[model samples]
Target: MSKLLNWFKQLDENLVKILLIGFIFFVPLWPKLPLKMVDYTYIAVRFDDIYLAILAFIFLIQLLRKKVLLNKKFILPFFVFLVAIFASFLWNAYITKLIRLPHLGLLHSLRRVEYMIMFFIASSVIKTKKDFFQVISYFFISVLIVILYSLGQKFLNFPAVQTMNPEYAKGYILYLTPDARISATFGGHYDLAIYLVLAIPMILSFYFAKVRSFYLYLFIGALLILLYTSSRSSFIAYFVATVAFLLFTRKFKFLIFVLILTAGLMFTTGEITKRFLKTFQVRRILIDDRTGAVYIGQTITTKELPAGSFYVKLKDQSKGDNLDTFRNQVVLERTREATISGEISTLVEEKKYMASLSANLRPVNTVVSDISLATRLQVEWPRAIDAFKKNPLLGTGPSSLTEATDGDYFRWLGELGLLGTIAFLNILFLILKTIWVGVNKLSFSEKLIGYGFIFGFFALFINASYIDAFEASKVAYTFWTLAGLYIGYYGLKYEKA
Candidate 1:
């Protein structure tokens, strides 16, 4: 161990950067710290967070010694963004009752510092062609292992590394089951899926740059795993990114081939094809007649009125709760009881009629309805808008609300207000602006990478309007690191004098 320490001490700054990048790329599966707490099983300081903090510290030492350079172009916007976040956090904590708890808002605001550390390290350290290729290649390899693990979970009943509080995480349980959406090594299915969205384009960039058969194999495996995850938003984001890549790089034939291949996969690939086809199904209307039913894991306040159920009547003292609440409660109670009695009789004759249709069409134990979109519209999005309206300048504050923002735009806007929102957008704009500086200076391979990052970031940005992709730890880490690599690849021209 002393000898190892001596060797480590002897190594120079370049080696430290290389090793940290490798760790960032290769170690998604290493954060399996076996600890659990009430309402939360995940550790407060996860392994990835530790690795990133170390990377940032090493970069700091290099800067102090004048051994490395920082990207000066981004410094203004980056720090401004952090200031906005902290300002909003402070306001919500002290003045407004938006976040209620000051500590929670402060905690959320501080997470930005951790995320930006990666951006700085990546943009500054990985500044050469050799470094860019090596780091991204390692990342591809790491995700390939992720794909294999997902397949194992799907085929072999592999147990998941539990990170969520089991009592509160039905989604985590669903992901672990056979025929379920696989999260692979990541903490959540959305995290895994969006990480693939950011990565699949870049891996394909390698293939287009050199026609490497190894990259081709990796791409195929990654695509298969992405499909198996069955995340509709991920699928959409990846498709758009892939299209942008093909158009920007002028790989029209290859693009056609991939499209055909994906179409073929949709039919030939068992669960994926079914999921893809399910996207087009009419979900608003159900054949059965029930006021409430279980869909996915939530109780659905379904709308196809049972014959005599719709009545514009005053609240009765004898009847408990409001109509909507009462309906949902009944649905939740029945769903819980349905876990025991599978063949419970319905209160309505139309429900019995629809029961046959549901048995044939819907998955077992789930009613034939989709409330995800409705929930976003009625609950999450409206709540964010309400918060934004109340405090348009700085909104509420950091994590003022629960994880219900569903949309990142609203999360940032509603939580941090205009000041935070503008800062956040500026950070992304400057990064992309730096990458955009070189139109003709980049080589074909470099152009492919630049295009891949641009398109990938675009997809994720759009995806954020649906889910809080920007705030998610793994996705945020990957985004900033990729942004750093792209900046290193083509953004060096915009470097400080």
Candidate 2:
């Protein structure tokens, strides 16, 4: 027992720092392979979970031994946020019974803590700027590997293990189709795209600060990967964040160069551009009043872009007929049923329909939205609103709305209500405040990096408006890890000054 205690006492902070460096590479590079499947959700307990658990255990021991000191910079907000999460869980699970499964709700609540705790662990290990830069160097190396693997997936037919669906979550290796977006080591393309949105700004900042060609090359590679991911929200977030970073850093001369490169890449990879154009279109739709049948006049070839249905009564059917229309579209029709001696009879009839419909039918021009945006607007967004309305304070609790809300704000509002949302936002507010104050104290290169991280966070906020970015494991974990390092480094500099 004494020997064991002595050995633990000898365990130093360097070991923890080394493990942190390893994690810098592991979280992004390692594929998400499920170790155990959980009920109610497809989100499985993976290798990363086990690794994080072990890391946390070791970190706890070091804290107990006084080898590492905790940073209490963002402690108050985190505590309040956690209280809100547990309060919501307890309210829904025991009081309201909105949470059908107590265990699932508890796990969902715990997962948030698991992701956030890394901030403290990362901060505890960074005692100096050297430690900060060393970890960042490993991070860039990991990014390079991720970019290379994405390229391999695009051209070399690399296999991927994705959790986009329940079946895929079972850990089957999938070879993506030629036109499929590259997810790299992430769960999906959106995850990959958001991750790049966070990293690209920092890469560019480093290049601009040091004028290093390697950093420039890395930026171009990451941008290419971002384009390949083909995530519209992340793409928009990337541009907004990059522009903000450059403007804040006063790198105005490089704006034209950045624009030319992005435009050229967008032109070369026209898939995303085409998707944007196809988001909304005016189309002719025929509706039958008698049978309540809807017929879309246009045919969609690619499954990637599906149109949303919207109907508006045409003031004049003649106006719809005047527009270019489908002359004769073949459709299945049902014949009237007749009863003879208590036996029902029916017939299937094939008919040709046109924009000029019968008196029982109405033809109108309706606007159709793409499936991606349509899902959020029609189903996911409304569902969240309904959940929020049910309990304006505590919400319907976590996991009540199934796997995704598509938007983080809606998810927070629907699951945790205003209290949870406000607390989490406070945490962000505190972090941003710390960054704003400490960034000026940093050296030239460090200051540029700080600016990059600040804008990267801004980009994520834009992404969260459309995507549940903070909910995703890879992106969320990376964000918190980098954020911790940034805060830790800032604290070190502030104390020194």
Candidate 3:
């Protein structure tokens, strides 16, 4: 027993650092497969959760034994944020009873902490510059694995396990259809796309700094995967972030090369371009005033309109006469199949419904949006705004907005309210501020990599406008981990300088 205790005591911070290195590969490359199901939510307790929980427990024990020291720089803000989360959860779950399931609400609140704990774990474990670079090399390898897996999914009929729906969350393996977006090891295409957006800039920075062919190949592969994901928001984020990083680093010639390469890849797929163009279009729709039934017409893709375009509702001039004129204006004959059941027999008839609906049909020209944006505008965003209106200070609570608001700002406002949002934003602000200050003291190559992190962060912020990228488990974990590593390295570099 004494020998075992001595051996345990000998286990040092290096063990934790090694695990953190493994984390860089584990979090992104591992598929989200459900190990246990959490009640009242589709979010299952996956292997990564179990892994992190164990890691956190070990870290805590180490801290207790004086084997490691905690970074206190973020404690205050993080504490306040935790307080806000619990306060909101308590208020909503018990007092007001806005949150129906108390356990789920608490779990939702704790999940935020779970997502962020890696930041401190990462920051505390970096003892030297070697540690930083070694972990980063592992990260590059992980990206390569992710890219290869994505290619496998695209060409080699690789199976995917996704959590986009409750059915998919049950750990079922799915084969993607030919036209389906590739998620690789991620829960969804959006998560994978955002991950690529965050990673590509950093890869480019390293390639430029070291002039390495391997990083260059990784960059190209990552871009191809990004195209395959076909997430418009991520595409936009990638373009903006890549451009900002290149221009800020004054890589003008390389900027042109990146632009040309990206353009060629984008055009080669044309999936993203087609989706962007299809976001809004002018269409003719016929409304039956009597039955309140709407019949949508063919899309006028040639006359593509900007989002929120005005509709032309033609005034019924001599209502009956106009209806007759519209019916006559229909060039093609349309038929509807109706099953008529008599006392003894059932008869199927094809009716000329277009001519018969002359009295009630009203034609109008309106702008129609694609399913994705329409759902957000019509349902998700409005629901979040309603929650915010209910409680401006604390909103409803975590899990109050259901699975997602599809927008991080709205999710924060709806779930955490103003106080929680501000506190969380403060944590981000401090991290960025620290990076900004400490990065300047580093060598030129290190400085570029640091700036790459900043731009990647900016890209995520842009992505957050339309996607809950930060809320995504894989993306969130990877992000906080990277933030911690960068800050830890920056602190060491600053001290050395």
Off by over 4 Å in 1: 1-10, 31-43, 162-175, 272-369, 493-497
The best candidate in terms of lDDT: 3
Candidate 2 lDDT over residue span 1-497, tens digit each: 99987776555647687788888788888888899999877889999888889889999998998778888768888999999999999999999999999989999999999999889988888888788888888888899999999999999998888989999998999999988999998999999999999999888877877788988899999999999988888999999889878887788889779999999999898788887787786666666776776666555664357666544443544564442243233222222122333223432211222222344555676766776787898799999999999998889998888888899999999999999999999988888788777878767877887888888899999999999999999998899999998888887887786
lDDT of 3 at 373: 81
Q: Model 1: per-residue lDDT, tens digit, 1-497?
A: 99988787657657556755666664465534433331322325556666766777777888888767887878888889888888888777787767776666776788888877777777676666677677777777788778778778878876565444544233233335554567776666777888888877777877887788987788777777788777777888888888888887889998998898777766666665554444323222211243333333233222211121111222332433223443444445554576457554555643653454344322222123223455676678889888899899898888776755778988887888898899989888887777767534666776776767778787787678777898777778778877877777676543432
TM-score of each: 0.78, 0.90, 0.87
Q: How many residue pairs clash in each candidate?
A: 0, 0, 0
Best TM-score goes to which candidate? Answer: 2
Q: Lowest summed-lDDT stretch of 10 residues in model 3?
A: 335-344
Residue pairs in collision within model 3: none
Per-residue lDDT tens digits for candidate 3, residues 326-368, read: 4544323323222233222322222234445565677666666
What TM-score does candidate 3 reach?
A: 0.87
Each prediction's RMSD to truth = 8.8, 4.2, 5.4
Can you tell me which runs of candidate 2 are displaced by over 4 Å? 1-11, 288-294, 298-304, 310-345, 348-361
Cα lDDT for residue 204, candidate 1: 81
Candidate scoring better on TM-score of 1 and 2: 2
